[model samples]
Every structure is written in C-alpha cells, then in structure tokens.
Target: LTFNIGERPTFRRFSTPLNQKNLTPFSRHRDDTLNDEIQSIRSLLDRASSGGDRDRASALDRAEKKLRAAQGTRKSYKMETRLVPDPRQKQMFENKLKRLSEQLSQCANDMKALRGNQQRGELFVGARGDQTNVRGEMSGDEAGNMMINEMNDIQDKTKSSIMNTKNMVSASKQVGEATMEELLRQREQIRNIDDEVMRVDDNLNRADKLIQKLWQADGHGQVHTVLRVRQHAAARGRHHLHRDDEE
Candidate 1:
C-alpha cells in the first residue's frame, strides 16, 4: 500500500502467512478463505462508502467492485495511482477561503454598527436629562423649590444612570469586538483544518483508487493468502476484527 501526504508517497507491504492448525469461521478450504477475505474487504469498503467523504467513498466502491471481479478470476494485479485536487478542486477551495474572509469582514462591520448605536442611545439619554434639570430651577415658590430640589436629584441620578449606561455600552462594545475577533480567528482556524482535511481526503481517495486498480490487475488470489494467515494467527491467539476503522 502507498500513502501520501502532500507530495510524498510512502510504500508499505503487508503479508499474511497460512497455518494448518486453525479452521476459520468461513471454512478450511482455500475458496472459503478467499470468500471471507473478500467479505472483510467489502465491509471496509462499505463503511468508507457511506459518509461525508464522497470522493473516498466512491474510490472505496470502485476498489470493492474490482476486488469482487478479481475474486472470480483468481489472479494477482496492481493498482494505478493518480494525483488529487485535479485543478478544479483547488479552485473551489480557494473560493471557499475567499468567502469566509468576506464573512469575517461583515461580522466586524456589524459589531462596529452595534457599538455606534449603543453610544448614540447613551448620548441622547444624557442630553434629555440635562434639559429637564435646567428647566426645573426656573420656578420659585417654596413648593416649587422642593419640587426643584427633587427634580435636581432626579436629574443627578439620571445623569449618573446615563454615564453608567455609557460605560456599560463601552464595555459591551469592547467585549463584542474581542468576541468577534476571537470568532473570526476560530473560523479561520476551522477553514484551515477543513483545507487540510480536504487534502487528506483527496489523498485517501487516490490511494483507494490505486488499490482497486491493483486488485483488478492481479485478481483475487491475495484473499486466500490473507484469510489463511488470519486463521493461522487466530490459532495462536484470539484476534479481534475491527468493526469500524475508528477503533
């Protein structure tokens, strides 16, 4: 098998040795062993087929079909390798990054607008209170004086409330800006991760396609070999099969 990250490919070989001591769940016969191996491979391909990774799934499906056909022929083959991204894919990724950048800019503008509105509201409240207080001092009876004092206190409290409100708004604006910046940063990080994931997915798809081509070129003779080896190993110790690759 060959695995690649970016431009470099690492080739690795796998082999299974057969032993006579243990009978596998399929059967003792070579054909049965081959069937079991094919089934296992099919299961892996099935899982890889069903998910968010369309390219990977398609590649796996192609490999499975090729392997199945090879099983009918009972021969050995080699898979072909292809480079991923195919130009159009690279363009799509670039476009997505550009869109994300635009969204981040829009988010910054919205935060600024919110802060401006908050500032304006505080100023309006402050000016209203000041007008009321100035009007209160002009009337002069004793009751009016008391009323004026009360009005003065109210005006002072109103002024203090307006100042507090302005402070709160300023603090909120700072917090909002910080939050927006953080979110933008996080979004960019996610975009970068997605880009990496897309590249990895492309590589995996290419690997899968290569493996399929190899299986088709050879035939299914490798199935018996792998199963026979697995059975032989199971005799020495209990071997667990992976239900899902996540394990």
Candidate 2:
C-alpha cells in the first residue's frame, strides 16, 4: 500500500540467544565467587563455637593462675580437692591460709621500708661558680639528684604495689571464706538430699506393702473389698445385737 522508500534510521528486534550465551560464563563465575564467600561464612560459623569455648577456657585459666599467685601458691590444686572431706586436706588448707597471712605481713614490712626511706636526698642539686665546685664538680650532683628522684619514683611505685598486694590478699581471704561457706552449704544440701531420698524410699516401701495387701484382696484392682465387706458385716451384726438388747 505504500512505496518502499528507505530503511528506517532505527529498528527494534528481539535479543538473540547468542547474547544470552555470552553472559553464561560470566554468571557462572559470579556464582562461584558467591559460593566461595558463602563457604567462608559457613566455615566461620562452624568454628565459632569452638573458638568461644577456647576463649572461655583461656580466661578461666588466667583467673585461676592470678588467684593462685595472690594466695602465694605456685601449686595448682584440682577443683575436686576442695570437695574431698579429709582432715589432712583441711590442715593443708589452713596452712595455705596462714601463708597468705604471712605474705601480707611481708608486704606490710616492704611498705614500711619504702615509706621510711621516701626521698632521702630530694631537691638537693648542683651549685656553679664555686671553689669546691670549680670546673663544675657539683655538676655530678645533678646526676645524683636524678638518681634520688628515680629512687623516690621507685619507692612510690613499690608502696603502691604493696598496698595493692595487701588489698589483693584481703580479697583472697574473703573469697576463701566465701568458698568455704558455700562448700559447707553444699555439704548440708547433699545431706538433706540423702535424707529426702531415704524418706522417699521408705514411703515407697510402705506403699508397696499397701499395694500387696490390696492385691491379696482383688486381682484386677488393688482394693481390699473382702476385708471391707467383713468389717461392714460385723458392724451390722453389732447394731442388730444392740437393737435386741434394747428390745
């Protein structure tokens, strides 16, 4: 119906399958990268639990070591030893407690010593332009003053450390006392539990005897129907006798 003039400047056509084919390898490569990333994430998740456990274990170990050092004991006592009810073990614990007291006393002495010799030659320094201090012989005094300053610094640090140690010792003693109290409470609880078990067993045994007696009465149901009937009959006979006596 129209003359075939010229081709249009632009044309629309459906995308060829070859274009999609070109993207297949790239898509596969991207999927592999994503898969690798997912695997890394999964690996971290798998290891997270064990790593958390290891971290917890390390922290507990460090705390144990520090507490032991505070108590002046290099020996690592097992957690079970605290539960063993041995008289000799009790004596050992007492001895260790005594040692903590002794160590505290030693720290006190160190503190005293540091305080007594605090800044012996503080603020004493060199003088210049003098006969005895000619050619600056008193220059040596500057270094001496520095040495004194350093000593004072060291003494101050030692005092602080001693106080900290004393505080730690006190805290350790408190912890020990608390631990002993808890142990005593646990022992009491265990005894109470044993008593409760015995009582339950006794009650169970009584219940068993009751059940056996009931079974002797009836096989289907553990009820003493025959004995109950006998009792009821005896009561009725007693009532009839009372009526006859009244008549």
Candidate 3:
C-alpha cells in the first residue's frame, strides 16, 4: 500500500498475484462500501420497532457480511505486499478496523436489545389476552410491572453499551497519542545523529589542519639544518662530497 502523507489516507487499489487465485479481488471502494453498510445498519437500528424485527435482523446480517468482507480485504492486502507498510499507515488501518469492529459490536448489542423488547412486548400482549379468559391468574398491575422491569433492563444494557463505546474511544485516543510520541522520539534521535555527524566532521577538519601544520614545520626544520651544514662547509672552505670523491 502506498502512503501519501500529503493527501488524505486512502486504501489504494492494488493488484494481487496470479498465484493467489482463491482470493477475491480487493476493491479500492471497499472502504466506502463498508462505511455505507455501517451507516445503513445504524439507521435501521434507530428506526427499529417491535414489529420490524425481520428488518433489523436483515440489516444485522448484511453488516456482518460487510465486516467479514472488509476483514478479508485486509488479509489479502497484507498477503500481497512484500514490504511492510509505514508504521503510521499501519496504525491508521488498525484504528479504522478497531472502530469498525466496535461499531459492529454496538450494532449487535442494539439489535439484541431491540429483539428483547419485541419479545417482551409480545409476552405482555399474550399475558393480557390470557388474563381476559383466565380469572385471577395474572393481574393487569403485574403485566405493567413486567414491562417496566423489561424497560429497566433495556436501559441498563443501553447504558453499558454507551460506556463500552466511550472506553473504546478513549483507548483509541491513547494509542494515537502514543504513536505520535514515538514518532517524535524517533525524529529527535535522527536530529541528534545529524548533529553528531556535523561535530565529527568539524573535529576531522581541525585534526587535518593540525597535521598539515606539523608537516610544514618538519620540512622547514630539515631545510634549515641543510643550510646550516652548507654554511659551515663554506666557512671551512670544504668542497662538496662528490668533488672530494673525484679528487
């Protein structure tokens, strides 16, 4: 997967190898499709009624299928790439998947709660009908109390779902913060390395200059000694070594 930092992150269209004929073609639009399915499910959940159990169940099924497809696509993408993705991209993908999973869980919980309410409503209706025929079996007050109890149970579940969602959001936020901190730490390390390289370069330049100065001083000292020997030989009126040998 190609990660362009400047653009909005998107799952690009990728081609799989011919050897992997068994896998479905991963679409670039899969993310969009998954999001649409989730939104549809949410809408259905919102409009859920005692009588629309079938519709809710159907939406749930569709959502589950979409989630599975998304998961499969993720697996396929991982399998196709030889190179590991950038950490930031990987984290983004993981966070998105986590969010989708949480959404699915919430949808499931809502569906279950709605289903329970529908069942309780049916029971309440049946009990009332039976009470009309059977005397002193179940009072109207008892039926009302049963419904109130069911409502309270549903409320409790709803509260739990909300709390769970909040916790997940908080966790996701923490993970993102950690990732940013890690990136910042790595950047600092890189800057330190660059600074160290510059310092080493400066030291090397200074050492080179010192070596050049030493070499120049040694050459001048040798030349001065030779001049001194020549002057001494001239003062003593001595010939050169080669002229002495010829004589």
Candidate 4:
C-alpha cells in the first residue's frame, strides 16, 4: 500500500504471513466481541440513566475508547489478506462493524444528553434551595424596609435626572435667544450697507451722465457742465452734514 509520484503504476502482491494466516477466524471472533460490547454498553447506559451514577460519564468515555480500539483492529484486518473465500462475507463483516460503531455512537450521544439534563436539574435544585434559605434568614419587616430603600434611591435618581435635563433645556434656550439676537443685529447692519451702496451707485450714475454731456458740449456748455458738477458736490456735502447733525 505505497505509491510514488511521476512513475508507472506498479503493484506488488504479498503472500499472507504465517502468524497472520488466522486473520479470518480472528476477525470473526472480534466481530462477536464487538457485538457483545455494543449490547453491554447499551445496558450500562440504561443502568446509569436509572441509577444516576456520577461516574457514568467516565464509564462512557472508557467504552468509546475501547470502541475506537476495536475499530482500529477492524481496519488492520481489512488491510491484511484474509483466508475467507467469499467477497460477500468480507462485506458482511465490514457492515457489522459499521452497525456496531453507529450503535456505540448513539449510546454516547444519549449519555451526553442525560448528563446535560442532570447538570441542569442540579442547578435548578440548588437555586431553589438558596432562595428558600434566603427567605428563611430574612424577616418580612427587614425585606420590606430593603425594598423601600431601593425604591427611594430610584426615585431620588429619577428626580436628579429630571433636574439636570431641565437645566440643560434652560441653558439651550438662552443660547438660542442670544444667537437669534446676534443674527438680527448682523441682518440690520447688512441692510444699512446695502442702502449705502445703492446711494453711492445713484451718485456715480449721475456723475457719468454729466461727464457724457460735457464731452459733447461746445466751450460755453463745457463751462456750464463744470459749474453744475461743483454745485452737485457741494449739495451732497451739505446733505451729509445735515444728516450727521440730525443723528
């Protein structure tokens, strides 16, 4: 049962060794032993379940180990040449081993499930006993006082949280009002700037029209345009001075 890569397939037939010649009879005996072990394990599981033995799980572990050993033996038997003439008989042995392994596995699973249930049952009983002990140790008045204290603590915490939330809301409202006032101030300033810009634009437009008229004028008309420009500038200065005085 050895192979080498990148080479032609060559198989060697090995004759049965003298000591191993009794493989067929030995395998048959092992099959019977495995069958009996399977039954024994089933009985052990039943007794353990009924009696609730503490060592039952460990016993199942040992049984599984033995089962694995038996399976290994069966594998070795399969590898070795057998004296049995019929292929069907060999297949029957293999099938029997398979069934036995499956039964053993089922028993192990049942034991695990039983152990889990037992542990859960013990925990449930322990919890109940602890509860009973605690109830017995404490007086009704004491228990009631403890509950009252816990309630008072919760109420105090709740009131404190409410107060903190109210303070936060008041602070947020003040912040919002201040922010709105500042925004209103900035809006008023922007409006004043726009009005000032519009007035300057109007003045620039009047000056541009006067310059165009002066450019198209004869000598006397040019002199008249200069006079009108000076009069306009003087009027604007007086208007600014009167506005400052009124302010």
Model 4 residue 194 distance off true place after TM-score fit, in angstroms: 32
Query: Cα miss at 217, model 4 (Å)?
Result: 57
Error of 2 at 193 (Å): 2.1
Model 2 CA lDDT for position 18: 38
Q: What are the root-mean-square deviations of the candidates from the true structure over C-alphas?
A: 56.1, 39.0, 36.1, 13.7
lDDT ranking from best candidate downward = 4, 3, 2, 1
Q: Tell me the deviation in Å of residue 48 in model 3.
A: 0.8
- TM-score order of candidates, top first: 4, 3, 2, 1
Clashes of each: 7, 0, 0, 0
Task: Provide the lowest-lDDT 10-residue window in model 3.
Answer: 22-31
Predicted structure with the largest lDDT when compared to the true one: 4
**Cα misplacement distance, residue 226 of candidate 1 (Å):** 15
The pairs that clash in candidate 1 are 75-218, 76-218, 77-217, 77-218, 78-214, 79-213, 79-214
TM-scores, one per candidate: 0.29, 0.31, 0.34, 0.39
Taking all chains together, the TM-score of candidate 2 against the true structure is 0.31
Candidate 3 C-alpha error for residue 242, in Å: 99
Candidate 2, superposed: residue stretches over 4 Å from native: 1-138, 217-247
Give the alpha carbon lDDT tens digit for every residue of 72-97 in model 3. 65454444332323455455545665
Q: Give the poorly placed runs of model 3, Cα more than 4 Å off.
A: 1-28, 49-86, 130-247
lDDT (C-alpha, whole model) for all candidates: 0.47, 0.48, 0.59, 0.65
Off by over 4 Å in 1: 1-147, 215-247
Q: How many steric overlaps does candidate 4 have?
A: 0
Best by TM-score: 4
lDDT of 2: 0.48
1-247 per-residue lDDT for model 4 (tens digits): 5567987777877786465556677778877776776676677667656543354555656656655665665565555424555578777777776777687678768867766655544444444454543432343344455557667888999999999999999999999999999999888866766676577667767777776677677556686767787678758856764564454
Clashing pairs in 4: none
